[model samples]
Target: MATHFEHLHAVSASQAYKATFASHEHTPSSSIKVQCPIEVSFSDDTQTQLAYFLRLLKQASQQSRWVTFIGHEALVDKNLLQSAGIDLNKVLVVCNKKGHSVQELMIQALQSGNSSAVIVTGDILDFTSGAIRDAAILSESFAFVINRQAKQQMTIH
Candidate 1:
């Protein structure tokens, strides 16, 4: 009887573990969207920053939608993207040639449901991250604001 009870407990524990982890797993077709508008930063002095960016971009491209880039065309080279295993056809680099502002473009892309992830790089501040978070939730997508900060230094305004 004790052995039977132990077996049932083991099964229940394993089931709980699976349930806990399944929600955190990323899938292209998953309805449970992840929290978005995640802010990340990298300094020019760091050697591993580009690698981290590539890894994150690769993961974001796993969805059916496009992985869009804004204001970072030089970094999104064909060779680099290919090395990251991201589909070249699914990648987009938009220039700010239009009258619309970069923030405006970011919000639109996040809410359009056409992009799996929208990545921007620059010294973009002064806008509200909450707005991006809301748009991301509405479209069930990811928004990455990659702030290229000062190189291993800080300044006070």
Candidate 2:
């Protein structure tokens, strides 16, 4: 059977594993008890990244759970999402502000039991290692942190 992680379009197995394992050191006898949240970074590929994000969000919403979208104002385009077949009703976009803490909001959203998946877009660097680990352990829901930047190496020379 395919795991929940397998349903994601943008996140690879190695990326997921690294994001999860980067939090702590594990011995040979140690085992991972909880699923690790994924971090996807996009540079100069907003369209492609958004497409993948929407696809993953759609898949997650299949479980009939709300999907929380935390992103900058420019990151989320309602029209794009609509055209991509995303159900607008299932999404709640949280706009990041100057004083507000995105990480804290993410943790609260995950622990609230209302959201099945949390999709965060912006700078991936803002999400610290501790925050990701804490969010992963606190909830069974899937978490994804997306970074939007200009892709520096898209051309093949």
CA-lDDT, candidates in order: 0.57, 0.56
**Per-residue alpha-carbon lDDT of model 1 for 1-157, expressed as tens digits?**
1121212211221222233234555332344134434344444443344565565566667778888887763245679789888887888887787887777888888888898778775543533456766786677665666555532342223
- Candidate 2's TM-score reads 0.59
Judge candidate 1 against the unseen true structure and give its global Cα lDDT, from 0 to 1: 0.57
| CA shift of 116, model 2, Å | 1.8
Runs of candidate 1 with Cα error greater than 4 angstroms are 1-34, 44-49, 72-75, 149-157
Q: For each candidate, C-alpha RMSD in Å?
A: 11.6, 8.7
Q: For this target, which candidate reaches the highest lDDT against the unseen true structure? A: 1
